[model samples]
Target: MSEAAYQEKVLEVEPYGIEPIPREERHGRARQMFTIWFAINLNVVTWFTGFLGIEFGLSLKHAILAIIIGNLLGAAFLGLTSAVGPIAGQPLIPASKRAFGKIGVFGLSFLNLVNNIGWLAVNLVLAAMALQKILPLGYHSALLILTIATLLIAVYGYNFIHTFAHWMSIIIGILFIIMTVISVQNLPALLSQSAASNGEFNLGMFILAVAIAFSYQISYCPIGSDYSRYLPENTSGKKVWLASYLGALTVCIWLEILGTLTATLGMHAGPMDFFAKLMGVFTIPALITVILSIFPVNAMAIYSGGLAALAMGIPLKRWTSAIVCGGIGALLVSFGGGQLADTYKNFLLLLSYWIAPWLGVVLSDFFYYRSGLAQNSTTNGWAGITAFVIGVIVSVPFMSSVLYVGPLAEKYLGHADISYFLSLVVSALVYRVLLKFRSAAVPVKPLQFEE
Candidate 1:
């Protein structure tokens, strides 16, 4: 069967992998992005990222402000990458191959491998923890169950994921809205707490809070276009961009603020556990909601990772690649579940460090060199790789992590990590300069790829 025929049914395994989607196979409304992304962020991880803002020493108001600013910036990057899908008709990293050659994109594949596996492990561990709360299920048992459940959806591929996300978006959105109403009761106690001297805003920490939310949302940029490449080629770029921006921005802010409210109440526990406990008589239902939510978010991670494998020339189908990723993620969960809160925070930061520089090159190629967007070739890509490396090297000194704290971060940023922002700016500037120099010498024309 042809790719489109096999992929027409939701349950039929998808045959298209990293190859440019055949136009006949292309289908989906741009509005689906809004629901897909809205459902994607409706998970414990998104909530916890927001909760970290409060934990980062911000008052509820300051944390909310940081979240809004951070998400606004991050979601725009996500939308831009996602918009590339309909134009490029390939997975995100593959769409990027023109900027970075086929060989050069392997670096992206490696980074994506780590990013997806790390996030899948984190989500699995959290969902397992929630499952344990739902009953007396052992952590390992719950982890294994969720790992299988999440893998099934990922392996089932794009149509399945889209259909699954559509219904869950509505169902989960309503449940959370009800939960939001209940959460407001916890807010009155915060007025006195906000008046406390400890509520004084710390600049470094406030910026750090913004960076986390920014990193958490924009980190998806690497894999984002994979989800939307199936949209018709003529799909409105404005609609595509708006759907991605609003869908992710709205839910992420809502959940993060929701997390902020719960943290300010002196709840000392993980996000799922805290929410379950705070819900009082609604405990069972709340836990059930969390348990049900594990698949949508984690499936996206696994699905994108699967495509990254194909883009890297891995000799496996997308479904098979998803299984490999699932296995690795399960191993991560088994070996590292200690000090999870700290691990998750650092993981979010580490993700942005690489992605920012990478995105800088992509956005520059797409918008600045508009003609370059029409190119179907993957060249040696020295310009992009060089800019990418230069971006990372220059920004390392500004990076502050437990693994390594740059002198600049220690001396001036109060240990806050702003490496992401630095790399983004530096990389774009370097790449554009290189492009200008290259173009001035040679009449710039698109290079076509040959088999």
Candidate 2:
């Protein structure tokens, strides 16, 4: 179960391929290809700040600072983790199989599935809320619209998801930009009216907001390699890094501006409310269009989640799993609860539990253990898994508000972000020590494609 032994085993290959490439020419330039994937996948409802931004009264400066910190951190991991795509020629779950082992796949797979389902629920809420505004449709009908839209695209699988996402991201970006420009043009007058408004904005809350934003995407870095796996092996690392970082940063910055401005204007309302206000100015059609933009993003959630399930030994095809899982997500909309507030908090906390630990493991294995060589499939690196578990355990105290030992610790540990940073160190140390105690006799090789 040592890291080296596990990697050596997983990378050992059979003399055959598992999933063969199609003979037909695929349609997509790398730029367009990853543009959409990165755009929609990166910007989830959490960016809107209806829950976080409006509640905290974060201003333009606060949002900017938060986004800058988040993007720098997020982009760094994106570059490091995204390199797995061209190298592995597989999705995230498969690539993760190297680190988690076949059994570890179950936890990762389930978490991914749950995450996608949660996103689907949130989108359903957005779509339903938008529909409620424009049409005579009640919440039920709107949920139906959300479900039908998600189901249609999700059935076609990854190729369609990628292509559709590319186009949608472009369109969504343009529309969102128009809205932001209008809002900014009108912001000065609006802010002056509320210049004497009473609202407390502190630096600590702003940092937490930024941490939350960054934490949302940080968790997905482990999965970034999954997307990159399909890329051409010769794709430049610099290009891959640049494409991902630029694509994500562009979208994140725009949304933060939009979300923050909307928050300030509708200081009396929520994020969804601000979106509604802008929609009214743009007209009903514009609102529907923006709401519909959720489809491409949801498609990604389902696709990534399904793949994660498969890697965990699910006994279903990708399409089948997507349908069933997505349907379950659609069903959650009936409750009219997206858990946006709690979900954002949990995601931030999970940054410590999942992302930081995984990042630590990957970096540790890659640089110190693997020496940049690929790892084998069957190798069970219990050291890494143990590290992850310990990371989660140690992170729990910081995650819970009730576990505070002091005011300073309460402030620091009360938030979920502490999980990510704390887990990174704990997991890395646990992994290092475990490797020393449990040695294995094998040489780690390149990642072996499943046959």
Candidate 3:
């Protein structure tokens, strides 16, 4: 292939697949991360996560606190993962090959691929619902439209994803501002309810609120670096971290608060009803705004999912993998159109189960056992996979969900899930300890500087 073919074109499908982005071709600044992430989280799902805070029985004040705290914690990890992108120059799941070994990473890769599909279903469902409001299309037809639109962006790959998000952030930002201005009328309803439940803040409910929000934000961590790998090799990791952290943190908290108020105003109805009531004739416009915003997030899920499938040794080209993922997501939406509220909550909780421990392994490998990440030998990292498995096993007793609340959560923690935290801490500590006995045959040199 000609060298010019390697140059990322403005209006072309991204030719690159899962390969590490070359430094010579790398472009963009860390701050661009701000727009991409901010745009991605503007959808109703993140808003619904906040509404869940109230649904879980926390006071509005407590829910907002939980939203802030959860986003703070989750965004930190999100930032940490994104910061490694320019240096690692590989897709997030592929970079894990160093820690999990080529074989062990497959399990994690599979988990990631599952998570991506679930998210794709989630975002597409949200968009389809919104699309159904404005267009003549039914839910299935709207879903079909969204599936094709998102697949195009994902197949086009990196540069297009970034460009799409940057513009969406500005457009969505204005639209949400209008919605928020109209939403101010509902704030009194939320505040009044807050005063009633304000003193009865249940610790279990509060923790659950934080966990759900944290889980949602941290859900982005696994795919955080996928977009940033195209940045210049010398990109400042700190700036990248800050950009991603603030971008997600800002919009997430904003939407969650707005969602809480919407829920309160709707009473027996839901947030969407609240939107319809509040906006009156403008309801169609609001839905259109929502439909437009979903593409950025759906694109991210499909794009990263394609990479995750490739990382797991799926023998297809990147674009082909995106097609498969989009098809599966559309199929999932067919079965999941009803019971969205319960389905979405359980989905968020389940996502935390595998991702937290996986985070433990990746963070340890990238930061503490830095040498392993730079090494080409995937067979040298069994210690990481071992520790990761142990962490997940240990966390099983503490798992809490409507699906199955673990005994430890019921017996001791009042059914508030702390398993996510336990998994991360245990995996990190164990991996650090195991590193002492673990040795590779080749002389190792830690990656001390950015790529």
Candidate 4:
């Protein structure tokens, strides 16, 4: 009743950096492991540290709305993809190939590459800023230190990261608790501030905020299955599903709520300034907590980037890939990655355009078209491509702002979150229509299952 549809024969596995697991060892228990995995991955540091909700929306309510909507939608997407993880026993990039086609995976990869690189760069600047505060070094020296530290973490690979997360979580969790306690004590009045004081309560801004938050992490969450794959073959998909859903929802709320509260309390300083204000007397512990929390998460980013590069046939070891990519990210930071906010906005729009449809096609293809939910043969189908193109085109008018082109455009057209819903609708519709013509295409292969 069960068989592995994809052959174990490694096709350029060296290049892809994907070593197939022996069939017998494929599944595992999801219990505490998934929670630990999810907890470590929560990585709310970037989301909060950057003042994204406040800065982007220019209002507390706007920020809150973005946070709430973004996390909810993102979690929903993660749930869809994660369910496929245990069943198929494949990582995100590979499973996605079924929808995007082999070459089309590049479309996803390219957008992901840009997004990750941009994110990595932003963090690099952030790390540099943090280091510069602690030390007397110039911006250049600080950036160098930031790059080297991030590289060291990245080179050590996942085992090191897992350990780092376990220990760091204990420490950071304590610090976060302390910080929250402190904030609540001093900023008691923040609770009364209106979320819509700056027009954040309006429908457009509210929806946009949610769209931004949702878009920010869609690329990141798709790869959750890659890490979750280490579980014992007997692991239930429900465990993975719960872990992923709760993990995203919890962190998004944690970070965003804090941010909204912080904004309301008038701590709306720049990133480093905000940290300085909050960490006043306990600067050392605060810095320690921040570094420990951010380092591993950034390492994971570079690690994933390297793996993706390897998967795309780059002749680099995983560690080498990490070092190379981490170094590049660090350099971007050193060279004044100050344009990160702008980069993020544009990237979000572009990504939303590409991914909304890609996701629609993937979900539609897997849940509706392909009966084999897990363990299947791979096919680079046209369904995803058609959806992707349609999504991008439809999002064009809406995404036409400074983020995509330049500052001049933003000055003229102003920013809006219209791209979010537009792309999703376009992608969903296009995918459905494409499925009608997909009959002549090669039938998707089902996963190999063992009886």
Q: Return the clash pairs for model 1, or none.
A: none
Residue 320 CA displacement from its true place in model 1, Å: 0.7
Q: Write the per-residue lDDT of candidate 1 for residues 1-451, one digit (tens) a residue.
A: 2545753589888888888788888899889889888899987677767777778888878889999999999999999888878877887676776667777788788888778877887778777877788778777788888888888999989999989998988888887887778887767776567556266668888888888888888889988788888888888877888999999999999999887777777778766668766888887777777877778988988988888887788899889999998888778767555245357646655655889999998887776544434364546777888999999999999887657778988889887778989999999999888877654323344322211
How well is each residue in 418-451 modelled by candidate 4, as lDDT tens digits?
A: 6656776778778767766766444454333222
Q: How many backbone clashes does candidate 1 have?
A: 0
Runs off by more than 4 Å, candidate 3: 1-4, 266-271, 335-348, 369-376, 441-451
- Name the lDDT of candidate 1: 0.80
Please list the residue runs of candidate 2 whose C-alpha ends up more than 4 Å from where it truly belongs after superposition: 1-29, 41-47, 50-54, 57-59, 190-203, 270-272, 336-352, 367-374, 400-408, 411-416, 436-438, 441-451
TM-score of each: 0.92, 0.81, 0.93, 0.81
Pick the winner on lDDT between candidates 1 and 2.
Answer: 1
Best by lDDT: 1
For candidate 1, the 10 contiguous residues with the lowest summed lDDT are 442-451
As for lDDT, the candidate ahead, 2 or 4, is 4
In the order shown, the candidates' Cα RMSDs to the true structure are 3.6, 7.1, 2.3, 5.7
lDDT of candidate 4? 0.60
TM-score of 2: 0.81
Candidate 2, residue 408: Cα displacement in angstroms equals 6.2
Deviation in Å, model 2, residue 245 alpha carbon: 1.1
User: What TM-score does prediction 4 earn?
Assistant: 0.81
Instruction: Give a tens-digit lDDT track for model 3, residues 360-418.
Output: 98887777544425455446568878888899999988888778788988888877888
